[model samples]
Target: MIPMRMPWRQGDVLDLASIGSRVDSLTDLSTIDGGPGARLTAVRTQAQAFRREFIETGTPDSVTTCDLVTLPYPTRFGLFRASRAIAPFLAITNRLLVIRWHESDGTPRVLLFEPSDVELGRYTPYFDKLAGRTPDVVSKRMVTEHATVLTHLARLRIDPSEVDYLMFDHLHTQDLRRWIGTTAPQPDLGEQPTPVFPRAKVIVQRDELAAMADLHPLQRPWYQPGTYRDVPPEAFLPIDGSVVLGPGVAVVKTPGHVFGNQSLVLNTATGVWVSSENVIAAECLTPEHSRMPGLARWAREWGQEVVLNANTIETTVDQYNSIVLEKTLADRSQRDSRFLQFFPSSELTASWTNPGTSPTFTHGAIAHH
Candidate 1:
């Protein structure tokens, strides 16, 4: 790693606005230049080149999911009419991805993706307003498995200080005050919060990080705007558009879920897998196979290739294109070739916690080789 001052202003270091500035609409770019299909092909070519280089020498040797927590998600949001699931609330499991890889120069790096403090997440008004009716006793039982990001990292024998990058698919329900440390002291703790990964820098999209400061009315209920105020500027590595963090790994810009929403792409021994909440299940990529009553029929009716978790959709078209980019970039699933290998960072699972819902297929982990 280059010797740089701690808390460096990495967010300011990259000129990331080109992705959002020139285009009047990302979808419009489609007609002029063979649309998103052409653009996606270019990206896939580049991503595969990166992967081939990694595999010939060495790809990522360490990559695993750290199951964090589960919550009650409204069925409507998870399926977005892709599934005619009648359940009011479905079980959504969120996890963190711990990735270790080497740059072409041989520097090792570690990134923690979506290492959320789920307990703190319960307060999100968007969720509370939707799943709030469930009793805590019932919600607590919703997830049969539980783990913390910090605890899971330790079990893997990784030290917090050794962690290099902290990332998220989006900042919708994240509170980084404890993870990155706060500049101000707070109640209860009596002192400023110390960071979990003191030397780590968060790699977030430039626009996404900026949006957290002054959230839109639509964004307010979901973002913890207050949690970021005390974070030091040097603690972030904000970039614009798609970025290949290292060999075999790229964080591609996937707008629509949020303007700055991006998905993680990793090339594994089995194949390339894109991970994000762009959709919540493996079948969402191939909705025709969805067992949910409405999902398959709705997808077939519309000639749609992907079904979104459309709880928030001011930019639905862009999300549709973005998810297609993911599906295009990923390899077909080994277990089920009919589906793409794109995995949901937060997968839906059947648990007594939310009795009425179940995913046609679940991919809880992405460990290959």
Candidate 2:
């Protein structure tokens, strides 16, 4: 049906302007408003402009389908930190930003927000599973990013304290349960799991998450670099995505191999930049065949994965880093997290994608941390 669903394989090439025209859905933009009172206005005037640019550059023919789903802002979740984590700096910032996204009429809808510290780090049974783990502090790059968000919020005079949860609009139910020790109904499996966060909002669209799953480009042998491993039902959510943990930031679903696998998208003055979390290379969360309990099995089901980010978007990784590394920010050092110098071709690169080479659905992803 969808060209035999494959990971980042070479496909059609298109631009953003065409993509905008091809996709019927557009961002509501009202979500960006501070709250209900200000009369329905565009969420962020700045974001609206960025959206225009993003659509203008995307390629339509290369578009792949994503089964990714989306929810509202302020989705809450817990974040685990590892000292030797690949993106340790991003982990810290996760505490403040909630990355959420949604899909509407074949387009990806995204949003960013903040959550209260208590709501974000709520302890779950899974915490006991992470006995050997500890929290990750903010990296220099993260601090720089935080500073930028703060500057924007300050200029708007929005009190950060008002935020109770940095919710993500998207996440995998399996991963959600594992992270928070909550149970969800597996009607598909005729299994009833304990349901936690009865109040937590979840998006139930199927095709988008499925499309997102196809991005895992290369699968290696059980021991190779870009391969995938079978994950346990306990490890990931039925859906494929992650919630954002911080303010003005969100996590988008980038299914490579690992369940609960995610990519980070930061919204700054410069523009929106989605990170390639589990795409290409052995360093990704999902390595070649290395399945464990409590993870997403779809990762192994699909072959290797790749994230393609090959368009000349306004924001540059260098500029993004500079924004995060502002003097006022004292988070992690530049050495802490590796920042991209240039946006590589999706066809050539394993872990980066844009509208040109890959298919993406927009949605509201939560922010947390």
Candidate 3:
């Protein structure tokens, strides 16, 4: 077990009340169906019951749930490394890669890269807010705090030469700006002039580069209609096609969702497994505006479509892609259209007069009887 500090009062307990309060539609419950959701619910209820049973009956699991605390930093770092190691190959371009290393002799090292200036500003403030300190301080502290973990990796039982990179997914990177959106001095951050690994040339897909360029007010070439938005133009480079990075690893362009967003499909005799970071998340299963296909277009943003290889390896498989064109067209048709909405109280009542049940008021985050 790893010793770590809890950031919140509830420790490892997820705030169900907070999650429930955020639900605005039935679609919210769609993702909560059987399997993990059910399992999660059971765990929560069992924990509550155990508390009551132990407090009243003086009996409980030998190990209490609260007592089995999670190791925060190590877990986070592990996941971060995994995302970075897998992303470029997986075709994921949105996540940031932070590296920390320690020499076997005990010297500490920390490396940080923002890929670009916009990503840097977004993540810097996020690290600051989350750590309750300035971004640089938080970064330094993360290294100091996880020095032991770094030491362990450095002195690997297996040769260091055999190991390559570490990678993982980071969803919160995009959400970092939510707290400071359109409020204060949110200036446009410039490119990251100094890279974390100055000696190593960062491998950025052409698509990612194009997408980055399009984010600038002056570079609008990538966002033209018929061309996928959010993908960088370089993603279309011929070299991007099934290029071998290592003996076993290869980079394949699987764009969908955003123009440059990709997934890494690992090929081993066992099977081919794809790691698509942001193709979908738990929240996507919900029936929210975000899930609606055409919803983002009005804001000049476009949804990414995953590219699956077929017999030709250049086009989508016929059997699988039959519906792709139709769905894409439907989504395009709804572009710039308003979402479904309810009317004012009097109008709603008049429209619902024939209904048997009493009318319920619907507001963004509030529903009244």
How do all models score by TM-score?
0.85, 0.26, 0.28
Relative to the true structure, how large is the alpha-carbon lDDT of every model?
A: 0.73, 0.25, 0.24
- Model 2 lDDT per residue over 85-182, tens place: 12211111222232333223443332222222222222322322232243344112112122333344454344444222223222311233311222
| Regions of candidate 3 where Cα sits further than 4 Å from its true position | 1-199, 216-239, 280-369
Model 2 poorest ten-residue lDDT run: 70-79
Tell me the number of clashing residue pairs for each predicted model: 5, 117, 29
For candidate 2, give the lDDT. Answer: 0.25
Q: Mark the regions of model 2 whose C-alpha exceeds 4 Å error after superposition.
A: 1-93, 98-110, 113-122, 131-253, 257-272, 275-338, 341-369
lDDT string for model 3 (5-40, tens) is: 211122223232311121121111124557543633
Q: Which model, 1 or 3, shows the larger lDDT?
A: 1
**lDDT tens digits, residue span 1-369, model 1:** 222222234346654342112111223223436665576555455445544543343357678887888766778888887665556778788888988987656777888888887766655777666556667676557644488777898898899998988888998888777788877786635779989889888778776766565566776777766556567877777776666666566677788899889888887888788999999988888888877678788988998888898777847877887787677678888887877787788888776544446777777787854
Candidate 3, residue 62: Cα displacement in angstroms equals: 38
> Pairing residues by index, what is the TM-score of model 2?
0.26
